[model samples]
Target: MDIRTLQEELVQYSKTIGIDKIGFASASPFIELKERLVRQQELGYQSGFEEPDLDKRTNPELVLPQAKSIIAIALAYPSKLKDAPRSTRSERRGIFCRASWGQDYHDVLRDRLRKLEAFLQERVPTCKVKSMVDTGELSDRAVAERAGIGWSGKNCAIITPEFGSYVYLGEMITDLPFIPDKPIEDNCGTCTKCIDACPTGALIQGGQLDSNKCIAFITQTKGFIADQYREKIGNRLYGCDTCQLVCPENKGKDFHFHEEMEPDPEVVKPVLKPLLSMSNREFKERFGSISGSWRGKKPIQRNAIIALAHYKDQSAIDELKKVLIEDPRPVMRGTAAWAIGKIDGESSQEILLNAKNKEKDQDVLNEIEKGLQLITR
Candidate 1:
């Protein structure tokens, strides 16, 4: 059983099957990552979406007993949207981050992992294997860094020399003692572009992120967006690309290797007003295929309302007013009330006042009051 030969064969097979990059890593406990995660947890910097158990997240052996090596894979996604529809005042649009541009990368990466698993099982009939994508307990970036797939960038993304930071990452843990690849050298030297470009200053210094302030995290929350960050979120409906978009390492790095990763301009940057009133069925039928729709329509619609306000598109006033008056969700109704005031339309004051009188939710009433204040101010 020549593990080195097997590793080489796996690497070659990965490339043949559309994996942009693959590297082997020792499946030892991630010591540094555990410490960092502990600090992040202590500071309340972690996004609640992560697997909560620290030991489970850091120790590979817990996930797969006798885990000896890990295989990390990267699949490049298109950063640039080709032939994107223009956003005009009459038809304002909100942008979904490049990550959610195409078919959910989770599905795309999971399919690749399944293929790799099949290939490995056929070669090593008795060896055990386990795989995970972003949703898994293991940190994909940590595995990728250890596997030499890429260096960890200041934006907290695994930056490959060939694909920049615009790559989806996944890993497979197995009881195969494949030689580990050398970790890549960090290339972010004194470059504060990503940190500076962060609209909400989510990137605290370099590599550290306060998820509470991250627009990417904020866009996923199914509740009222804090007033301070609402304006900063701008037209982002899901996730934020400011950090990656500003990185020098990512310059001229755009890959369209996978057809499934291509962005449909209309879906990724849909008209803002239409999204405000979309039924669940309509929203799913249009956006269910994309990763951004995982949080459902509430957050997207809330951000859409904020986007309309960002544009100060008075034309959306009628739709926003309807949401404020008729929407069942308090978050939707409240956000609409806030957006209406932010827009400061000719009839915004009157509409907000009427909603204020009839609104039962305390939160909605407070938002109505804020809207009234915005109009008078």
Candidate 2:
């Protein structure tokens, strides 16, 4: 089999299977990324969610011993929600980031990668291939960048001319030597929008992110949010899109190419008060299909509490009181206590004083005290 023809066939097949963009690159070691990863670790900027091994993360050969080339694919997702419901004072809502708007991209991209892998295997029976989405060891951005799918933007996202930064990336490493495409030039030359818009100053500079300071990362954390960032969280229930939303490249670049990527207005931007009382099973039934639920309901619920505080939604006082007094999780109770104080309802001080007495967890007690202080302030 001519490897060139096989590559061409794979590319065509990819289009037929709904791949938005496809590119090829040599499965060479990512030398530059290795140095960045080392520096990221030394600075403690890692999100703690990445593959810890630097060698495996930067070297495709380590991931697939027989690798000779990589096939990078991108699927564009909708950046804007259609007919979106507004969040009003009476019914304050929290938003999940655009990345979590639709069904989990992991499942969607993984399905596409498997089909591509099957197509490759059918042509070259002796070829070896390994496919990975976000969870894979090799960096998807690095692979996509080298393959000309897009240039790595200042926002730390792969910015394709067609899809902007609102694209989901996946890659497959193959043993066969497919011709590699040249990398796209960096187009974010003078754009400081994404860096300037980051609420937490996570974008330390162009293409570098301190995940600890990233609101996107902070929303996914299972523990209590830091005081400094808690108020900044706003109404975001999961992930943060300020950086991407502010990019000029993404202007009017909404894509509804994939039906699975369309968001259900109610699910992605749900009312805040209801989320505080959602049972684990109810949460699963409502949000299990989306990517944001991967961290489970706790983080989302925690953020919901903070969002209520951000809005100072007096209507949510009862919900916050219930969570403070009865929620088993200390993080939830603590967050609710803080929110009640921040909201400063007529009974807010009384509720926190009551919770402070019954709260055995020192953390929750501390939050209750803080809530009382907030009310006093």
Residue pairs with backbone atoms closer than 3 Å in model 1 (clashes): none
The lDDT for every candidate, in the order shown, is: 0.93, 0.93
Q: Measured by C-alpha RMSD in angstroms, how accurate is candidate 1?
A: 0.8
**What are the RMSD figures for all models against the true structure?**
0.8, 0.9
Model 1 per-residue lDDT at 236: 92
Q: Which residue runs of candidate 2 sit more than 4 Å off their true CA positions?
A: none
Q: Residue 295 error for model 1, in Å?
A: 0.8
Q: Which residues of candidate 1, in runs, are more than 4 Å off? A: none
- What TM-score, over all chains together, does every model reach? 0.99, 0.99
Which lDDT tens digits does candidate 1 get at residues 149-193? 999988989999999999999999999898999999999989899
